[model samples]
Target chain A: MSGGPAGDSAIVVSDLRKSYRGRPAVAGIDLVIPRGEVFSLLGPNGAGKTTTVEILEGHRRRDSGDVRVLGVDPALGRAAWKARIGIVLQRSDDLTQAGALTVRDWARAMAACFPNSRDPDEVIELVGLADRRNARAAHLSGGQRRRLDVALGIIGRPELLFLDEPTTGFDPEARRRFWDLIADLARSGTTILLTTHYLEEAEHLADRVAVIVDGRIMEVGPPQTLGGRATAAATVRWLSPDGPRSVQTCTPAALVTDLAARFGQDVPGLAVERPSLEEVYLRMIGAPA
Target chain B: MNAAATLVRAPALLAVTRARARVEFLVFIREWISVVFTFIFPVLLLIILGSIFHGQRLPGDVDLAQYFVAGMIGAGLFGVSFQNVAIAIPIERDIGTLKRLAGTPMPRSAYFLGKMLMVAFVALAQNVLLLGIGSAFFGLDLPDTVGRWITYLWVIVLGIASCTMLGIAASGFVRNGRTAPAIMSPIAIVLQFISGVYFVFATLPNWMQTVAAIFPLKWIAQGMRSVFLPDGYQAQEPAGSWELDRVALVLAAWCVLAFLVAVRTFRWRARTDD
Candidate 1:
């Protein structure tokens, strides 16, 4: 196999930092995203997620950092680099200026700016906006408007895509549909950098998840294994004669077997549970209260 | 992956500019308020003012209706090129449209070129409409000589270019769409009144005329007057002559100044961006 323009990595960052008015927004952080991977950055509102993403997108100037997106330093990104990357912003208010340009009109217009662009109609269908292709941007619902954004983002056939809290206002069904669309994009070999407050969204969509807090990264790993979640102690719970009884043990299977044998019959209401990704993530970010 | 194998050829610059202009024109025409203010208001004002001054005459035997016909054309040019762009761009910024484009591979020149095309088309159409109406009903004179026609062309081109650049520069001062009209409308209306668009130049107060002379609107209206009014009417001008040289100089100077100011002040993102 051959490496890309820079290397096997689609994105590389080291000692990334940014500040506003003498206050640090993104403290030192490091990350490397391999090509064709779906990477998610999970953090609280002020935890520097947007700052980090904007730096990588070249929408912002970082105070200090060595960051490469699609094998080019984003701070020095030009037309070529921009052509290779796509961006979906967080809100639909941005589309207010779209005015009377229909979905297909906007898509075709955006496609004209890119060197390697997908067919506008195909992209519209890919984002599930085919039915509303002729509708003006203002006439679309919030979720549909976002789909148009995604459609525009991918129309350039960008190798790397940045989605900033893309599903914030989406309903459950729309979010699920969006996740499927993202999954399809990932399967087609696009590298994705997603930031979201939804833990399940990260767990569902990301090949690797990084939890950031207080301008710093706390951990980075596959969602199921983050914070040692895969190996962490599991809790067993069942009904006892007096009340509910539970115990946390590393040997959960052994404990469950022992309880069943002592009970001498099917243990009523028996259940074993491992720490979910949300639980581990909250704990890593110190959000427990 | 090989760059050549995977990369598709981008659309040509001309094609992109055309696409952008198409979008801009659609947005401009669809916004009913802008259509009313930019296109309709000037024509209506001209008709009303021409009727009010129907039987009057200036010192050069120039009919008052004819005078206002030129004034309205000048005002219409300013409105379409300057006020339209000035207000539209800030609103785009406020709505994040400019930032969205910045992230794309579209060249900055193409974007501005698209804007210029849109403004030029609107200005041309507006000039024709105002002039046709002026000639048919208001008895305004059309330039009969080639020299006067040449002067007309240069003035319109310079006036549109300078005002468009100034509009782009002025957009930077507006914080958002809500404040755009409040800021842009007053400046435009005040300039019209003080620059002889609504009244004769020599009839205005001395201080107002002086203030108006320093701006481009005065020169634009003066240029239009020189084109549409007879050669002998130059005696009525504040300068006692057409001063075609000064008209070109002032408008050209403003075009250069506006370019500089826009380069320094134009912003791609709203002030609220992080």
Candidate 2:
């Protein structure tokens, strides 16, 4: 499946501000996502990831901002603009209402939203829900419901898609399968803006990642070096006589060399490592657990 | 996109509306409780109340059965159309149906329009049931004036519009889907009681009648009674005259007011905005 016309900036936002009852949810945030890129917006819960995503999706109005999604301001986005953007809300509203409606029926119903939509069966297959295509949505498991949400979002063949904590309730196997589906979509040139609390998901799926803290972007870069995580002090751990011993230092090569000379062999359980994406993300959000 | 394509891509307003209507219709019919509450329950009330008050007298010599039957027709109209939405819409909004559809390429008006259409259809059917039962058991006569039937139709439509808007307003503030029936049932029961759904409003104290007048449910029932019942059904059925134009105008005004409130207050997402 060929993707749509690639854009240099699939989405752009400058000084976006949103408030409810005088409390700013998204307080003057800026973001840019290039076309055909899987960009993850990582944050703890209530860090404005949802608000930012909502504004970009044209689902919420901004108090003030100059923004663009697919070259049109989402605030003024008409029906045509919406057809090109798909969203998987934290909870799929369609799932509860699915009742007796089959998966195929739901897919076809969502497909009717856009001028050019994907084939229902193809979308169902991509989500790995084709086996339950005839089953009612309400009867499906949590993982199946999440897959259905993905199916509906992509059925319109959206140029830009938003997945809000899409794998929240997914099992490990289901999540891995979903990651594969997302990778396929990204490879086919769909611009994806994914907000997930799962750091591994960010590391695995995101071409670039942005960490938001208290409604502000703390850092935006590839997950490996996010906030200088890769270059930060590396930790060396080994099984010393006492038990596990660890040392933090800047020059891990020197430390390893010294260890080799002293031990005169491979230090038992020797390993050098930098901060993981989860560590960096948690530190950035100031939730060091 | 060109103008032709743009025009064709106006969010499939008709399709979404039709689908929502069909789904709601099927779901509503499939629920045995809704069927009984809307159709069967009203029929049972009609029979029991008609027999109990067959020879009861009122200030206007209006037969209690005839009076109760006419009011119930209005009540049926209000219940199926207004109460239905007041109860259902809030639940849907709390559950995220409204917000979910909002982001899609679907026009927002289609949802309410299809509901408006469904309300009209259901209200008409309920009227027929009330009239049929009234005719066979209570010996009531259908309206002879084509103008009266047309006026009755307006009353039902306007009445439902107002109630549906109130439902939207409630949905905007309500955060829990489970609390919807709990919250709306009392309002429905109160309005049904005051609108003479189970009894005549004039029997209540003068202050109660004045309070009930603020709502369109009473206006619709009183106005409809003027059409089906004799001219002097109620002494002050909208300024002491059975003017269909005035009833239409009054009900229309309530509809406009409720619509404005609904638009201003209706939250697409729930209060917590999940």
Candidate 3:
């Protein structure tokens, strides 16, 4: 694939807004996703993640704001512009309608929609669906059907790909496998924009993550440092003569040193735990749990 | 560079249209229920109705079975073109198939054209089945002369085009796949009756004739009657003459208008779209 200019952003948005029945779904928002990065938009249900992605995919119209995908305004995107992007919606079992269509047949049909597309058989294998190549799409398991969705998304060889809640119904092993597939694609320079409710997915797959809630972005950073998670205070615990003692402190390394000195060698039941990405996310969204 | 990005190219519109049509046709034929209803059910209905009033004579001495043959052909065309499309398109939308296509590079025109082509194919198959049943069992007369056959050609073509477009246009009002049959079947049955598919148009009340005249189904049925019935049979028509030119003109007008309405109203999203 011929990479475009390195400095070009795969997607850019400024002051983006959308409303439904007078209620704002995507209030004013701004985002800039550089080319060839795995960027995840993390949010709870009804957080406008889908609205933002839809506008980017040209499936929706923005009320107001400048939005560009692949250097062209998505609102004015033509066939050529659409050819450069791929979208995997939250729920699509399109081949189910063509009940007798096999996985290979579905891939081939979808491939014909694009100017350039991967070989249907190769895509089938890439999605780990080779063994079920002749199995009708309606007969595939949920995870297998999802793989087919991904296969269709990438068949056209899109420079930018949008994945909306891709792993929603996947088992843990299937989710992990899907993550690997996405990571492989990203490594090959495909710019990915992903939305999901799974924070661990964001932590594992995203090069950078944005926390969106109530149609607004709360934080944008690498998952480890999101909401100052990396530098956040850690909890230190150790067994004491009385029973146990614990303290939350920013300087956990210093506290460990002092505890070891006081205990003379080893600190019984010693454990230092830093805030996890999930904790930071839950705190940001203000969910009681 | 990613393999996908490297392979990006604009597929030819014709290729996409052809592939989509093939897939659609395959899927449609695989559904035994659709095949039976679109092609066989109408013929069965004609057989039952034809046998019931087999030897009854109309004003011009035309057999009731023969008159009903023409009427059933018109009804079959309407069912394959209008009723089928109205229900099928909404089902696709309800199931997210249309939404999926919308996100692709395939142009909307190509998608609809593919659908129209599939409907046309089904309509042709239906016409053949009905004609075969009418000729073999009911002794229904067909257009014998070249000119009459030419008239049959245009009438069937225009009838399919106009009715298919009307069905697609009406699909916009259908809430979803589940509601499509409820909304479409009754209207089709009512039109079939008022348009003289079940009885003689002249024998119907004057107001009912006027209402039926406003639609293309009546004109199509009249056109088919002109092709099959003997010359004297014009005496039984509402105008006391076989106005082939008027039939063509009205159907063509409806074809154009219905195409415009379909283009204007067809939605790519589900009913709940914002």
Candidate 4:
């Protein structure tokens, strides 16, 4: 609970618990995100990811435990504290009703809320929204609308940003572009905490990740090492003369070499496969294959 | 760091309020249907009803057109202040707009104040249009003396505050955007009838009169009538007098009560907190 200066870490939580009508949503969770790291919270639907993020964002009250964002306990975070953080909510169709105001106008208005903000047009360009700066928010396509959400979130030039399930409806190309935008933000030293159901997205962007299932953090690590994904037994397979043969082995290279020596030629359909991050995640969550 | 230093001393709350007000106003103006309904509908109703009953007289020798003009203005004020706020707030909540705003650095008071300012602006415009149409075409007298103008100002201010707060308080009952209009429209129509916006209060049943007297809409209508009607026309009122003191007292009390209720019950998110 005694994390140093709020400036040292973007977020710190300990023994956090929240319930909805006697149903536990986030139970005894603990986490710490250093400054400028991209931390992803990965969970299946109804796994308390949104609840945990909302609690950290100060949008929901916790039943018990300590929580801090930017050194201030979010429960007591006022406007001054709020100004230091940015939040792109799970679903925000705000300003769609204000169709007459262009994207730049919306950004300007949002920027005015913070103590220090990026130039509106610069933030728009950073989100790849400069071309449609004059377009009304209502007219933007779904992916474009999400980009605008990101633009608004970052316009405040916040020290920490929270993105809840961003890129949910994005196409493949749009999703990749969004990843780049987020990477650039991280490069510029803005701490990011993102929640997503997309495992590949978490793998691509997260410097560290926490997998939550049924209101608990089942595993926490870098994407490569999550759930021992890096060192898990590899499955070596080859098409033998009889049929396809496969074995799970600790040393896949030795298994492949023995198979090659026995074949005396290239092993047909030879393959050595380690479990993917998604597979490890699904197994950890106890999902039915 | 320099930017933060500069903004640390700036009136950041006021800036947030101004920005929110600007956004609210922009959204309001873009809703052309709302604009026509809130501002033009009242004047149109007055003109049509006034022309049809130009020379008609009510039970107490009150001219029907003149009285109707006053009533429509009152209704218009209620429409822009109370009905609009109540309906719009729930819609914002349903759309997650309020939830998003709640996460921002904008103070909650600044957000509500911004909405109130927009409502006040539209209410004032509706009043000006109604008064203009009434004076120019229906032979209604404008408040000429400073005292009458003062009364007009206080009545309008207090009316808008009370009605708008009540509207915000009522928004809590609307579960989502789709049901907001359905729930609010029927209630507004019923209040209009009971408050004598469309009919004579004295002619109504005693129970209906009592029901209307409990609400602020009735007092707002009575206050407007006091300002616009001749001194003798006060006899037509249910109280048999302008009762300006009671009007002020009732409206002020409602304003305070509604403000407290709204602040207590307001929800930034569509769903329950738990």
State which candidate has the highest TM-score: 1
DockQ of each: 0.53, 0.30, 0.48, 0.44
Fnat (0 to 1) per candidate:
0.60, 0.37, 0.69, 0.59
Residue A125 lDDT in candidate 1: 92
- The structural similarity of chain B in model 3 to the true chain B, as TM-score, is 0.93
Give per-residue lDDT, candidate 4, residue A89: 85
Give one digit per residue, the lDDT tens place, for model 3 in A92-120: 85667657678887888889888878899
Query: Compared with the true structure, what per-residue lDDT tens digits does model 4 show for residues A1-289?
Result: 2256656888889899988888998889999898988999999898999888888888888999999888888887777777778899887766565466789878988887776778899988888888999999989987888889999988777889999999898999999988999999999999999999999999999999999998999988999999897888999988988999899999998988898899897999999888999889989999864
Using TM-score as the measure, what is the rank order of every candidate, best first?
A: 1, 3, 4, 2
Best by lDDT: 1
Residue by residue across B1-274, what tens digits does model 3's lDDT show?
2445433444777888888888778778877777786667788899899899788988787888899999999999998888888988888888788888888877667777787788888878888888888888787887789999998999988898888888888998888898888889888899999998999888999999999888889999999999888989998787989888888888888878888887788888875555
Tens-place lDDT per residue, model 2, B1-274, is 5668666766567777776676567557655666677657777788888889888876666777888888777777767766677777766776666777777777778778877877777776777888898988886778899987887677776777776666666665655777767777677779878766677675677777788877777778777787778766657353566656666776788777778877887767766652
Error of 4 at B222 (Å): 2.1
For B1-274, candidate 4 gives per-residue lDDT tens digits of 2557545723378888898889889888987877886667777788888898678787655677788788888888888888888888998897777887777777678887888899888888778888888888776788878998899999999998888889988988778877887888777779889998888777889999899888888888888888887878878777899888998999999888988888788899878644
Worst 10 residues of 2 chain B by lDDT: B234-243
The best candidate in terms of DockQ: 1
Candidate chain B TM-scores, in order: 0.94, 0.88, 0.93, 0.92
The DockQ ranking, best first, is 1, 3, 4, 2
Worst 10 residues of 2 chain A by lDDT: A1-10
TM-score, model 4, chain B versus true chain B = 0.92
> On TM-score, who's better, 1 or 4?
1
Look at candidate 3 and tell me the lDDT of residue A156: 89
> Higher-lDDT candidate among 2 and 4?
4
